[model samples]
Target: METVSLTINGKKIVTEKGKRVLWAALENGIFIPHLCAIEENPLPFGSCRLCFVEIEGKKEPVASCTEEVTDGMIVDTRTESVLRLVRMAFKLIMSRHPIICRECPANKKCALQDISREMGFKLKPKRLPQILPDLPVDDSHSLFTYNPNLCVLCGLCVYICNEIVKEAILDFNFRGFITKVGTFKNRPLAESKCNSCLKCVEACPVGALSRK
Candidate 1:
């Protein structure tokens, strides 16, 4: 409940103490590009790297979605180093993302697609591995399908299902690079207590989870 004042993008703003930099920036009307931090969800899941910002007194750049705002803090929402890092992060995220923009239903409406174009990533990176793994597509559920390959591991779906819906149906199955979101016992979502809620599908920024 405590309040603090900070300078973000040269604008003075007051926010509650311990508020994440992302929430403070948004509340103050400073739009920093972000994908994984949804307002209704508490889990930050700062994997996107799109909300990186330069904060004074910090050695390296920190993720706005995860960094807590401090009093009298000087935060640069857009800087040369921050832009470079963001652009690179965009490229990396796009590398594994499916290139179904022209043929897929989401297409222009896709958040990832829109963000990539906005960031001026015209061509995909060639240095990164071209061979992407194929994850199972779960179509048994009447409402949605689970395609782990397209997932950016943003955890938005997991958060929505567990935190918002209170279903606790989906979760990460493994660890490290092999990790993928799945239901308990790796059963189909239809077999779980999912309640056929489409909140998870709606929360997914990418086509990793979609309504069928």
Candidate 2:
């Protein structure tokens, strides 16, 4: 495999050719906040919009998850502009996500919590008014629960279900702000004929899916 030389946050590194900046940074112990990155997936979804990084010569920051690492590339993961963008992205995700870490299953293990801690951002958004979703929790599955209100719509579960697990049992049910992960015809998990693999639950970044 060919290797590419690059500098991330002023640290010189070499990664496999064709690797994305997000994975390269992560593999080298450099953290770029992200949630919607699955390295095996051919195309990064970039739904979370949390992995913004500034590359030399670029006018605007680019999502590290979707940006392929190149030889001689210089990546800055902590630029002022990059932090501003990442902070806003975190805030936007928090605007809809309920802050219930004390009561939530994910709690300290949650991706949002990790991002908040790593980025020095608060869990609650100060600028945007919280628009809490009133969706009921789905405990129909014998092994797990689905809480749409706590969901960040990172799409990891959906991608894992359809692409990795090949279950095709879950997907985004609606459009826009009302969108959520759901079974076919909006059926309950018990009626969806899910095989109980629980990969989706395991892949979920937030506690939207959790063991019962």
What candidate 1 gets wrong by more than 4 Å, as runs, is: 1-3, 40-43, 175-178
Winner by lDDT:
2
The sequence of per-residue lDDT tens digits that candidate 1 reaches over residues 40-139 is 6556877789999999988888889888888899999778888889888877876766676675546666777766666555436656764565777777
- Give lDDT tens digits, candidate 2, residues 67-90: 999999999999999999999999
Best-matching candidate per TM-score? 2
Candidate 1 accuracy as lDDT = 0.80
Q: Measured by TM-score, how close is model 2 to the native structure?
A: 0.97
